[model samples]
Target: MGRVPVGELSRYLLAGRLSTNGCLTSFRRTPRSRLVGPAPPTLRPLRTFHAAKEQPDPTHQQVQTPPTVPLRKKLKDEAKQARKQGKKKSNADSQTVEGWELTVGIEIHAQLNTPCKLFSSATTSFNDDPNSHVALFDVAMPGSQPIFQTGTLIPALRAALSLNCDIQPVSRFDRKHYFWWDQPSGYQITQYYQPFAKNGHITLLARDGIAPEDGKSVTIGIKQVQMEQDTAKTLAHNDNTQWLDFNRVGAPLIEIITEPELHHPRTAAVLVRKIQLLLSTVDACVSGMETGGLRADVNVSVRRTDDPSQTLGTRTEIKNLSTIKAVEDAIIAERDRQIRELDAGRQISSETRGWSIGSTETRRLRGKEGEVDYRYMPDPDIAPLVIGSDLIAHLKQSLPVTPDTELDKLISYFGLTPKDALSLINIDNGARVEYFYRVLYSVQDMIAADDLDGEGADVKTYAALVGNWTLHELGRLTSSKAGPHGTVDLTFAPDGDCAQVPDAELSQLLYHLYRKHITGKVAKELLMALYLGELEDGVRSAIDTHDLWFKEYSLEEYEALVDEVLEGEDKVLQEFATSAKFPQGKLMFLLGKMMRAGQTERIDPANAEKVIRTRIESLRPSAA
Candidate 1:
């Protein structure tokens, strides 16, 4: 029997080679000391001899190797270390609300804006008859092999590039096994093992009261973006049964997983919206949460500042959050729940949960599963995807300027403030941002082509005017419900009808506004009339019919209106005569009456004030 040192004991136990039969079976290197005796006694701490020994064997000395922990134990230890590090890092500088430091990571699934499904030729359009878009391959019919859609690849690539991912040239798919009613194949074909993109990052400028006035750039880490198929929709009936609508089955989807870097719910919500805007701008996905085109899974956890090196609190995964409010609300509720648990001395359970929009609370769904439970394996039927130079080039060309890039350009190019630029590209008006740019650039192009010169017709002013109207008035007309923040979607109204106003009419209205033909108010009225179909005749006809043109009254005409006001108001003239300090006060009072008497639009209010003041001064007696 050989005397194994204390450090070697961990290795032996981890290796599982120290059998009950008293034999060391697994060893990478032979020990310097050979086993020469029988079974040893109970192990104890090695004692050092203070007295000098003759020819002492150094091999018998207690030389300890770094303990070799078991693989599972090692992983657990590393996670424990990470949690400690995460807590320390979090407490070092993270913002804490309600005495709890919040940590959140969002996983978003955005349906690719593709005509067909990811692995089959089924239509990906929504609002079709139930099961109408399902193909044999979509339902996993026997002997039905999936053929990948090339169209779906482009959007994924575009999203990956826009999100600052390093696109892997060689990516493979794997089958994730799970038993669910919606998943017909009993497994999902996904790029789980090796995703198409990895290690990306997004810089989020906190808005919507997420940070200080000078909002910090919160850079969230993107873990990976994987291509996967959507499961079918399950509609529960009154008879305690369910019907499967496979229209969404096999639909192309990309899942973006972020690191646990988000600390505020508002910041997390804004980040989700920003990602949605980026995807929509690049034509990667529709990014409509209401239409089931986008979904988010949020992981929320909390810890304390006192225990900086303690493990992070258990996390709860809130699944399938369809709206931004849901994401924010769920995070807040979950974090509060965790804080309450901590305050009550209760342990938080790691579980999966569901959010009820009506109840506005997270309820337990099931215990969270480890990754090994999915049983991932490569799909033999499909080959690995190879993204070559040509495809990359094409994808790069196809992608529009990303949201951040566009925001920077708008701030620099148009001389707009960052807040104003962010307002245009905010998620609420994401879909309409391009339309605004189109109208603005069209005005720019016209100004260049015609070389127009006017008092208020500079490119910057015109661009600002276009942005204001497009983001404000036009957005209101196109949205079903306009709130203080603006609109989220303009494609469908409450009646399920498209709320799109004609871009041509909008362009014409902007032209009139730029050329100083109509005031901003008049332009708004014209837009409303056009949207309501009350003005069929184009922009000019609408303006002329409604008498919305900017009115310009001659100095003589304004003076006459002022005189009429003065004659009707003897009391005002008397007040001015007795005051003697300022005769123009009486004339200024009369100017308001003149403007209200059918000259509001006809006479410039400033010009009226000037003329009335001049007349009053001319009539004044010098020092009498």
Candidate 2:
């Protein structure tokens, strides 16, 4: 049977369905009218539900909620309804048509954390001067040969293992021939045929775009992880002359391919960010998208959710997406494009596209290339890469604790809530995580050293307090927009170095807070002092210098101060002591005056409230 126009099919299906009596009533209630287009013989629905089972049981006689309509179908139905009603359609309605379920898969290229290139000894550091760190082998010199960097494999292995991939026993390199101005070698070395690892999955929690019933996790499948060489950078000169920076030519990269398991564009973006944080925990990649340290290529397709077979439609590849926002925007735009084509009875072309950052639309780059087109051949120059059991075992032992594991440990061991634990980890930026752990262990050390006050110094409580300070108070101080200098000083050390604030100083400040020697406000001031390098002698010195130490007063003295404030303001006391305002707890307002008169140092708020309430009851004549 030949394909029919979508418009003709829609009109015929809708008109003929009304003749079926109640059979079409259910169809009308659905977000879209079902199409009876000819499907391929093999493309049958996977399963069928009986009509009796689909509808509610007659005995119950209760109304049942219809299944949720796919987003695409809902859009199309709304558009059709607007047209029939002679109303103007909104821009969103004009942008999309119905009946498509979007599926997205992402391929990520992460630059490895290594001192040298993958197949050469040349430095891989970014330099101000172009071509300064190039090796003869990088530029394809006649006599220079490739020597593999075995040390560089550690970072890649750690990444694959952390992602729960199975490391292959034997992997080999292949030459992908491509002629470009940036590739002096005329080919890239990659593990195309037999990659290093494969078959992994990640569970994405519904932290965003979720409803009460939609709280289940979304698991995405990983296809493979392969080691590859990065391309050189091309810089354009003033006269349109192009210069190549060979410094990055042989740099290491790990390419991760995922199955088409993502349904929403934002979900895809969130998964990419999670992967970035995971890799950062192991130092596998620098995890910076702006500097080309990481990039993603998105493959998007759409299908009919109501179709039984759920056959995937033709897919488009969006390449070199450098940011998470770009990934999401490109996928949504491409999904809309495909739906519009299908609704008009046109087939989507399988092609590679580039995302125009300014317009946020995709433009065709080239027809999508198949693996056969690359003519992949085994690299004769390099031997087959083999991993012995002993080496694999050692690498597994050396793998760092994954971020998810750390989150769990923070919760279970420290008795912290999931929110507080996540705040301590700070997945997007590990600076706060670093500070948290440093202070945490430092406080523990001080306790072990028998230096703490030892009365109310609980490790779990201190850990929670540290998380609050780091994420809340310290977070604001360091935030670029909120800070006084337009940036918070997160500088503990320079880039690529392990910089942490002094543990001794941090421990002292934590002790002060735990012992209630300083309020939370005063604790923040102490942290600022330490950050600014003004707390040279330690927490005590900072407290003295800033006059932030809490002042202690005798119990009798505090009671006298409270009595004086209430006695002096007789009218204020009468209003609070016996009026209806007493129910509103207006006595605390006058108690605040007593604390303020003593500089808020001589009395703890809790103690002051208890003492002032007793004094007020005596004045009420009930105590007499």
Candidate 3:
């Protein structure tokens, strides 16, 4: 077909009847109009006389010729009608694209907690010499074949099973090709088409100011969990040169992707923290983010639910956000950038962006790549992984109670609040958390015993005091020290090092305070002294040198001291009785005045308050 000029148009020629403006109309080109153009060479004049055979043809067949229309004019009329329809449809579907919505899906690649790499037996230690841990298969040397590590699979399976995901009976590996400085082979062995597990959910304890929870419960659905080999790390230089570290290459990695259910950056971080906790609980991964053991690729998107016709806006992936705070900032900044671009009537580009930690902004790195771009194929060297029912049963039986389940038990069994249970369950060390529970229960026992001994004490009050003090104050103190500064002071010792204080001793101290044997302030001072290893080591009996220190001060001796002080300062004593507010700057203050009067005898504040009250009573005039 020849190209049509812009000015040329098309007209349709119809053989059937046509309807226009509710009227059937038919027309033909007039002979006078035909004269306007040059007549065809075959044109002939009308014949006056005709042969009988030609004249009889009208009776045999009634010949009819339809008007012919130009092809260009027909095309123009069809296009005009199409354009009108298009305008009407656009008006009906129009929407305010002022704010762009981004749909984000993150694929986190975390290094598996294994002693060796996935395809090689080389040590997976991070700080070893470059290529020290690389094997023939890791570097993809010719004739060196890949082998799957059973050790790696165990931890990965444990992680998946703990997340309530099914352990597939058969899983396979594939080779994903991409060029990079660190990867000597230019390809990585990973799983793409088929993963080991799929469709799971993780419940996270949302942090304050992040979601609707405000440090409450939130659930994020997990889309998929896959096992793959990690890529080698590259250290870039200022001159654009790169140093390859093959130690990380071929290391087992488990990638967990979440559904785009998160609305805020902080919510995503909360999900990450919960996963980290669960991974730690299962002993599958460490909680350290700085060492590159764990990293996340955060996908972010936005949309307004009211508009149905509008297409979803572009999505950007925040690459390798290791720190929780950085992940949050990256999401905020990326969301704002997308909204601004839409507001300015510019389309948001779908791309992968890198987060600048120092500047705290996101910068475009590369456009998004389709699945086919990676040229993924089944890994030829390794055979298909086949898991048996027996192995699955054993794994299920061996798995510990998940953090969420344990958290619920903690709340119900120990009467802990939701917030406290969440904090306690997320601790890095499960053993420590268990020990804290033990101490809490032991303290309750002591409170009950004190009440039975005619020394009334509130269990709930003391339990709150112990729980808060241990979680906040004591935890802070222990964590601040670079080394062991003192022995562990607990209300009860659980059959271990003498470093831990016994519960009986703690109960004794509380009893003494209730009996007016020591002031609340003095009890803290003695506890600190005991924790500093000041008492005789391994002295399990409560009435040892430590108890002797509290018992030595007699009530009579303390009273006598107060009496002498009052007699020595009779003028001040009278003023204290008569004046509403006596000046104690020059005379008497708190226990400091008594301590100054008698340094040889260490008079604690508890004994002092009792002695002072006694003296004041003796000085008061008789009521009768």
Candidate 4:
């Protein structure tokens, strides 16, 4: 019998070994020394038998060879070798954490700011009547199928490209099976095996008291991003029954999954906010927590960095954190819970947990399940999405400057500190900062054209004043009514709401007050009146209003007010004449008193101060 090579032995054994009857079967290449008989005719061609008279017949030597080893022994040896190799490799690479390392990843679900749903023509507007927007596909009724919408895909692609992710030309969709009262279909149509975009990163801003500089910074790596349909919402009742609202069903949504890179819960929270801002800046999504436009599923796994071989600790999914602060709180609470469990020699289980806003703690709802539990399978109705590069490039070109780039530009253009620029840019409604720049540029153009002189007016100071008023006072007014951080969507028209106040008028008001053409009190009063809608219709300039409101007084009227003050306070005049410090102290006091009296009579306070100063100077020279 021929011996087989070790690699070919499995094939021979699988075909069955030689039969017990004297029949050759499953003939294999046998080891040369293991031949048990005279050389076969097949072997005769390869080697000729030579006459060996003195050393016995060579044929006898060939016949004396032992039979091949049994197949069972060979199989056993192979198994032992495999086991040995596995053990050696495991010993070298396996790491152990004192406690299990929790492997956490996040899945963020954000609603796209589209005019319609993913698969229907229903208007995607909020606050609609329940079930009014439902289409046959949204309800998953019989004979209804999904159709691709370019509006949905374009925005998602723009976001993916902005994040620097590789767009998958062909992406598959699958049905994710789960039970929820709101979902009439019993499963959501989502992308599973393949997704649209993958492998991107984002940098999150860290909170104060955590770490300064780069200590608390988090860089989250994305696993994939997919376009999907949002599930309907359930309105709950006290008796465990629920009311279904299909208004949100089939809303176009982008689901972004992150790798298990976040080491701390706070980091996860911070990372989510960064992504939210990115989405908002592109107009891809609104990311409003109050409006349910954004939601996150945070998975947390804990493992010691020191141990490489130990399995990671079980992770819990923190469900549906709406606000950034809530996200941070949820993460910290979960970390503390897991750490306490490990300290007590208790193991953390893989489960889904909810955050209690009142107590700020995680409450386990149910055990987490693997992907198979969803029974994901390709959706038979929809075909693979074929994305072209041209569309992607166009979208990229249309995108506005990114937040990071805008931050740097703001710092240089507005002469703002790094911290202030960052703070301003982080705001979701920060378009006002951009508006301020537009106005500043207009002012600069006016200065260059010689329409206004830049001598008495400092551009930097004026810019700061405008930024502070917009960011602080105006922001407060609008936010008080709309919500915090909100501002009126102003159009910088000449006479429209939120129109730009003219720089010349502002400068002129300041100049008059400084030169005593108008009192400081009168200038402020006039400015407030104009701000409160006192300006005439079709008014093109603030200077006209300032000149119209300026009050002129005769020297006799001013002198009378000054004399009244001096008569009532002879000690002040005496001090002005005798004391060296009286000019700055007592003499200024007399001037202020006279200004007050003049202001009551609609006279300019600046004139009163000037007249009083001149009179006191004349008296002082005589007294000396």
Candidate 1 vs 4: which has more TM-score: 1
What TM-score should be assigned to candidate 2? 0.74
Cα lDDT of model 2 by residue, 1-624, tens digit: 446557545534443212222333435444455455443121111122222345436796655445545445777999998888987443224322355577889999999999999999988878557888889999999988888899888899889987888999999999998878988889999999999999988777654322222246777899999999999998888988988888889999999999997877777887887787778777899656866789999999988877859788899999999887787778778888788788899999989999967454689999988787778999989888887778778878888777678877888777677777765554335655766777777777766676556564556777887677656765565666456642445554212122334656766888777778898668776677666666668888768877887877778888888867876677766775676445345676777688787756557888888888887766664533
Cα deviation at 530, candidate 4, in Å, is 6.1
Clash tally for model 1? 0
| Number of the candidate with higher lDDT, 3 or 4 | 4
lDDT score, residue 326, model 1?
80
Per residue, candidate 4 scores C-alpha lDDT tens digits across 62-97 of 444344555578788999999887643321122223
Tell me the TM-score of model 1: 0.72
lDDT of 1 by residue, 82-180 (tens): 988764332113235655678898999999989999998878867888988888988889999989888899889988888989899899999999999
Error (Å) of candidate 1 at residue 622 is: 15
Q: Write the per-residue lDDT of candidate 3 for residues 1-624, one digit (tens) a residue.
A: 445433332211221222221211212222444546543222111231243433436565645544544455667899999988763332112212334444556677777889988888988878777877778988878888877778888888888877778777888888888887667688877777778887888766533224553346656677778888778788888888887788888888899888887755666766776677678778787444666778988987666556868766667788988786777677777877777776678887778889978554699999887677788899887898888879879888998788877876766665566676676665534554565555666666655665767765544455555555445544543453514663343332222122444444544555555454555556655555556656555323433544543443577778767766666677766765675553445343735567667643256665576677666656555556
Measured by TM-score, the strongest candidate is 2
Model 1 spans with C-alpha error above 4 angstroms: 1-96, 206-209, 409-431, 441-456, 475-501, 510-525, 542-551, 559-594, 609-624
The Cα RMSD of model 2 versus the native structure comes to: 18.5
What TM-score would each prediction reach against the true structure?
A: 0.72, 0.74, 0.64, 0.64
Worst 10 residues of 4 by lDDT: 40-49
lDDT of residue 356 for candidate 3 = 74
lDDT of all the models against the reference? 0.76, 0.75, 0.65, 0.67
Clashes of each: 0, 2, 16, 21
Cα lDDT for residue 40, candidate 3: 27
Q: Relative to the unseen true structure, what is the C-alpha lDDT of residue 371 in candidate 3, on a scale of 0 to 100?
A: 72
